[model samples]
Target: MEAYVVATACTKFEKKPNQTFKGLTEEVYLDLLREAELENGDLIGQAWFGNCGMGTFGQRNIRGQVCFTPLVNKKLFPERVGIINVEGGCATGSMAFHGAWKDVVSGIEDVSLAIGVEKIFQPDRPDMIQEIYDGGIDQFDKDEWIKFYKDVGDQLGKPFNPEEKKGTIFMNTYGLQALWHMKKFGTTQKQIALAASKNHFHGSLNEKAQYQFKVSVEDVLNDREISYPLTRSMCAPIGDGAAAALICSKKGLKLFTKEVQDRAIKIKSSVLTGGKYRTLDEPGLSRIAAQKAFKQADIIQKDIDILEIHDATSFCEIYQLEMLGFCDDGKGGQFVEEGKTSLDGELPVNLSGGLVSKGHPVGATGLSMVHELSVQLKGEGAKRQSKRHKYALAENGGGVIGFEEAACSVIILQSPF
Candidate 1:
């Protein structure tokens, strides 16, 4: 049984409240349930929650129950709603949505709620980086992880390059890959700068985006370089945001109003995949997930009109275009140069500015992607609306162990009848 997203909501990361995690989560849930026309009492099944900075804010394993119970009547629906928490680095939001999708498809629940919330505004930047790097792993060996960076640098013939080491430390790993693409395909720094500039331009039209000012390619290239070949403009800014989606099976779908039913988007497919541990040279999980989604949706590459992908850096968007079968391998840089992925190009990608300008709030990023795509499908993206959109794809990845995604999830969405 295919699942459909009946309602969704996302709060701009920039407007975050200076409250506790529990407080913020309660607000998000209330907004979501109200928007979906779902009373707190109506959610009688399982609840899947995801957050990245819960521990940083002093909330631990019971974060899910604590945040959700306040918005719903726990006394009346205690046993009916089971709470489950998931953490997959940057892909926590997608993981939560995937979990709920599984339960609904398997007939385990008639209705399921997927919510992702995170707050990372702290006093110290290094402390926050360290906390994100550790990310629930038991064998937290910093030296071992640093050595892995050295190994990656060695393989790339850039031994003794401190940028590579630093890249591995902070999601700048895409910089190393970007350098490889530049060396092999003559991909100029200007091309990457163009991608960043376009994202910022798109973000300027999105009210929910963090950085809403337009930037030039020259501005991006001239900006401070976090890692060589990856300017500050290419990196995702730290922020707080929460997104929620209410999904229901066909039987439960009838409860919604005709207006809600008219705007619903069908979940054509949801695919989660991973790669060989500790290696970055292989095909990305996005490729694996897209293949499965396309097969399930009975669509080809050309059938997709719009896409929301994990562009944590300019290089990530380049490589993901190829991995997701939008272009040939090793030619993603060329594809971007040719304007194939632009809003007016053959396939418009990252229509929501992606993580680059939309703000990568870790746990909320994936669901945020879904929220944007669904709006586009419903003709509600407003100024950033696509010219023609029938099917859309959301590709989100999380963490970096050695080279591949520690976890990744992809979902294909289309207008529901």
Candidate 2:
């Protein structure tokens, strides 16, 4: 609780086919400096870098150095600044922020930096973009996910396509899960489309979002299906971006001027956990992580004024809503239907559009979520700013294990003022 995200920034989440991962990271750093009013990068004590698809491009081994070399050299920072490259499937950015938070909370460093960057779109080698599906699994066992999808197809009496390597397997699983939820709880496609419709409206307000155009629930339902019932408009697009946050201790906040301190958002609780195997009727890791975070923050879900969840698909939005206790079991669709998660609603969720509309570049998503929360809490969200920004939560998940996320992080933030 001693650490606070005093400053945060991110590049526009979109397809920058010509940009390198390193270049995107530098842009975020520059934005971070401008936001924090810090003239020198040397003030940073340590850095945690997050990236998910470095292997697809190059430099898989020395990823830390490959991304932040001469650009963040000794001239602007420490002679031997510690840098750690991290991969947490999609929650990579939040993992880096967690690492830096520990550094500051432990009183080992004054100012620590966490940055998550990823380049998933390659104009020439479009096939390489499929790495988003492969990056989470064991590279040694490449056929594992494919076989699962093939089995799913067989179960449904549908043919499997090995050449169907365009999108992420996450969607395939999400689609399957959506079917199960609909059957078990009588969830309708209209309910899921409502969530998508709300986010599309949110996206229209976010210039950084990949798809900024608004669509009606009917439009989302009628759109081309990615995996039946899950329309293309309901899924997150592949893109490239970087997001950064500066974590500082209470004493470190003194190092900044009063204006920055006033704008700081306190980290009340942060919980990260790996996946736990579960049956169809059991709880998943994401739900467990959220319970832990809520207990740590000493607040219930009703206290959250704003939320940004990893909505890879419209179903994911509903699923996570229930898992995170925003609504009763099998009632997430109703929650969205009632407009409880809109800007004018009591708890505005995903005001920055979220992954489905804002674009998901894997490693950068979690921190981008945090960046949105920071801006809202600081009353700097401009037109999209919610009147209720006192308490916020961000839930980001990565990879998959059976029916659970391989890794998940839940963070709660409180306005310092």
Candidate 3:
């Protein structure tokens, strides 16, 4: 059983919620459906929606249905459209896609829509920051959490000790993992800066990227430090955006055009796994998910043509590259320095600027990755197209409370021969 993406659309991240969830989603669906030449009435099947900032947007459950049903005359067949809400910190979008793909593959639905949208910009920056933190903040002893964050920060050399703040756990668990990698592999801050620089350079060429300016490694290194060895440039900016993709089975593909029919990109593998809650060790879910995807796709790591990783920070990208078997452990930094992940390198990665430069709208980030890969496969990636893309991989991780992710999804896509 195979599923293919027949249409896709995404909105640019804006500081203000100029477009409400309903407006943004309707626009994306209209555009994508138009491109696929599918009428609104054709989309009567189930849908998997991913969104962060629901509370921020003042929306209730099944946000996608509520936002899109009106556009299609409120005739959405309730029996046909089973809505599922997914929350995976920054990987919400990718998680939604995984859910939709599962439904189609399992014969639960012949066609399903996977959409990710987020609106974080509120009236106050502090309020928005609080909202973002609230998504990951554990409901344990608030003071203890704050103290733990402060200790983590102090150990990482961060200036602000969050432990002093009430109910604030500023621990970016990944920071500790990153520091470990640096200590063991001799990975330098300069190498991480280089990765950020590359992302910005690639992002500058993308019209949809929020930040279009090219940055230097020095700029990334010298920028204000959020965490030890992580500067502002190394972090992903929160913004507002939406991305949508229509997934359908082989039977449903007959409704599309011959061009789309002939150029379908099959879903070779889609794997979602949760973390093992183990700190200071390799993420079991990431490893297991990668293995499952590889086996399902019938391709090894060496055969992957391009990859879009959940690089919330430069180190995250490096770690995932190593963990996914793209390179040996402790050698990811050297791999980046060698230009192995560059556009012209042996394995191009994050060709669409990634979350670093692309603006991670949490829920929309995963779908954005899928959209970029699909565009690249179709030779429609305008400016960020890779040299060769026979197969593409996307890995999205979210909700970092401790050492492991709360949710993670890995998808393998291949251009049909």
Residue-wise lDDT of candidate 1 within 286-337, one digit each (tens)?
7888899899888988888898989888778888888889888877777877
> Which tens-of-lDDT digit does each residue in 150-212 have in candidate 3?
564566564344433322233355456577678768898888888889988888988888888
State the lDDT of candidate 2 residue by residue for 1-417, as single tens digits. Answer: 388998999899888988887789778988998888888677789999998888777677778666777565735445678898888999899999889988998899999999999888887886687765676766776576567656756765554565554356677777777877887788888988998989999989998888888999899999888766688888898888999999999888888878888888899888998985466668677898899999999999889999999998888888888999988889888888899888998889899998889999899999999999998998888878999888999999998865668899999999875
Worst 10 contiguous positions by lDDT, candidate 1? 159-168
Total backbone collisions, model 3 = 0
Question: TM-score of predicted model 1?
Answer: 0.92
lDDT of 3: 0.78
Return the top candidate by lDDT.
Answer: 2
